[model samples]
Target chain A: MGDYVFNQRHLLGLADYSAADIRHVLEQTRTFREILERPVPKVPTLRDKTIVNLFYENSTRTRISFELAQRRMGADVVNFSAATSSTKKGESLKDTIRNIGSMKIDMVVVRHESPGAAHFLTKCVPAAIINAGDGAHEHPTQALLDMYSLLVHFGRIEGLRVSIIGDITHSRVVRSNIIGLTKLGAKVTVCGPKTMMPPFVEELGVRVTYDLDEALRDCDAAMALRIQMERQDGALFPSLREYHERFGIRMRHLEQYPDFVILHPGPINRGVELQSEVADHPRALILDQVTNGLAVRMAVLYLLSGGSRV
Target chain B: MPSRLLHADDFDRTIRRFAQQFTEPYDDLSPLAIIGMQTRGVYIAKRIRDRIREFRGVEVPLGVLDITFYRDDFRSLDKVPTAKITEIPFDLDGLDIILVDDVLYTGRTVRAAMEALMSFGRPHRLRFCCMVDRGHRELPISADFVGITVPTYTTERVQVRLAELDGEDGVVVTEGA
Candidate 1:
């Protein structure tokens, strides 16, 4: 048997990838790094393949990046906006995905607001599924991009201290990053307000703390999660000013560790979870994360499409 | 089919003969360049370049041409071929470029490689070099500098595994059923 079997059809969580599997994907990404520099900037690897993007959530970067990655790999890309789809007309999510699957899609990249929506669609459609983002459950592609960014910056994944701060309970990026970072041998810690922090998050093998200052000290890198304003109305925090005063990473909090790098899964609220100065710091890799997002997503799509079978 | 095996010493002797034949004073051409079709051919060109550099103080400019997309038998490969990196840090314009490969068989690969090379730039003169020139030419092409010529029947295969890639230097011939 091969060292790994890709029998699992959908990527719904970072927990799906083992250390070996993540390493394989990263190694494949290194090969694809060269492909991105070509004049034509595409490979005929997935020629004649069809990839459908089903996004129920509003997105500017993730949806577009996934579309571009699929098209660049020689796959036919179909964008399904849920706002105008049959789902808005009383058709069930299952029925809509089934109807699309009936048209012969090779893969489905889905982004939905409800948690586990991608997992549910995977059961409905037989096509290979990639979760772009599904509510506060998981955004695995973001985590993969973060991992790729970390690997590029540090040159190795093992033996590093990574702290994820702000809205741990509500940030799908945190859930995925915790799983991805820990699996790659990096120690992960989650810090946020007690109300915003999820109960038993430590059971997932990440250290949880309520003090941002304690977590940020002497860490290799820190990723600030965006506070979901939509969820703030339900008593997640008392006030925006209180949240920023306590949990928001600012220039002073960053001074606790001069060697640390800052990251944000953006559409970042400039003053909410992270300060503007900290987000734009010299060591901040927020933009690099966005640039690496394309390369990493391309790597994932290429590998999941059986590019490594050669 | 019982074919004669050329030992390592015999292989070295063949390369020496080709070097002597091609390195004559009359064959000294200006702006002599060597380009290898990547993967196996690149190593062969490096060896020839090293030998030439030893005899003369001037080192020839080396280039690597990848003809992966231009292959005629691409469909026969079970999966998409991994793209090999093509590194040609020197200009090929107006130079007498000698294309090198490990083995010359059907000549289709060479033809495809020549087409691919032309896309990069036009060369002043073009010549072919091969470590082993087996007797099978499906195209109207021949190698100018040959290390060894091996006579073989249709149902036979000659495999060359170089130390740089395969961890050993050797050649093997096997009968095809």
Candidate 2:
């Protein structure tokens, strides 16, 4: 009875995915993960396909993970960054993408500063569009990999207590994680400073709290999001040290909450979002998240390429 | 029209014969390993493995291969294929591998399996074994050890039902699209 079917093309956000759809993607990720342990991890599944990585914003992990996944699947990849491209010559997003589309691409993995930019591209080109991150709206691939890490650790996501810590207001990660985890029947609680917390995030079916201790109290898993120092220049918190003292997951928190494990969508501010020691602890899945990100991104590209349309 | 070619009794006798034929050339089966293609070939491989152990008192390492990623006509398929795990616990270096499958038809699956096997390591030699050698050869490949050969139209299907998967063991022919 493992007849799970996932027919979605573009991975815009978790808000568009159902529980079954999420499960199917996770299941496929497990298969893809096994390939990484092989001598020849590369597969020729996407040999005939060409993909374009169009990044309007800067990134390290997500971009690299997507590129590695695409290349490993034997796909022809073209990398484009808006900072060094025709965008500097005052070219609009529509004009730029349409021009790239003229080169005949099968898919586009995009990260944009404005929300709905990925959704807007779906109407512009025939190629499938995947949202690497779209402003503060959603970073779906991050959330999927986060869920995959949790699944690898706890063995299941349903009925598990997950606490997401830090920068909910500016995080596309938190938005996507909240939607994805809740859809899979996990209890989600977001912990951050009052200014860092978004308005009515509880409306998205998550518990909002200012107390870090209360959030980590009974949770099975805790994901500490990166404090977006680059995104918020208006001083949302008093200082990095004070924020760490108040909300950062330190070594003490790891010892105190022995049951709950740790995760971080990384480039961790060593002493800010999470303590340096806690990030290296055995309970921390920060590194596993990176490896799983490659697998999850591969699964997303494989599924969205409409291989099932065969 | 659907017709039965062989029943469960025939399957038992054919598998035992294959085990007997396996030991005719080699005194020691240590250099040999069995690899079954995914789906039905796995069950056939297991049955042959059991018979070999009973006949020769030597156990060979068995591995399963899924060739979905190595398939040439992935774009022409009706659905995207999910790849299964290729778990070959032992090293393939300097070993004679016996690749098993339920049917030998267009020989495309054999080609894919051979390509998929190379990723592991270089084998000393590789041999093909199939339960049925159905007519229609699209590739220059043939089985070294065949249970039976049945010539049929290109539109006909050869259905090899194993007890492990289909609740019975039999070879049947049916009309197909």
Q: How do the residues A171-193 of candidate 2 rate in per-residue lDDT, one tens digit apiece?
A: 99999999999999999999999
Model-by-model DockQ, in order: 0.22, 0.52
Q: Please state the CAPRI-style docking class of candidate 1.
A: incorrect
Worst 10 residues of 1 chain A by lDDT: A1-10
Error of 2 at A197 (Å): 1.5
- Winner by TM-score: 2
User: Which predicted model would earn the best lDDT?
Assistant: 2
The CAPRI classification for model 2 reads as medium
lDDT of 1 by residue, A1-310 (tens): 1445444445888878787767766765665565565544665556667889998988889998888888777789889997888878888788888888888887889998899898888678667789988888899989988888899999987988999988888888988888888888999988988988777888989888888888988688898888887756488778888888998888887676688898888888888888889888888899988878887887777656542221
C-alpha TM-scores of all predictions: 0.81, 0.95
Q: Encode model 2's per-residue lDDT on B1-177: one tens digit a residue.
A: 789998999999999987787667788888889999998888888888999998788887899888877889977764576667677778888999999999999999999999888878889999999999996999999999998899988889899998878899999999988
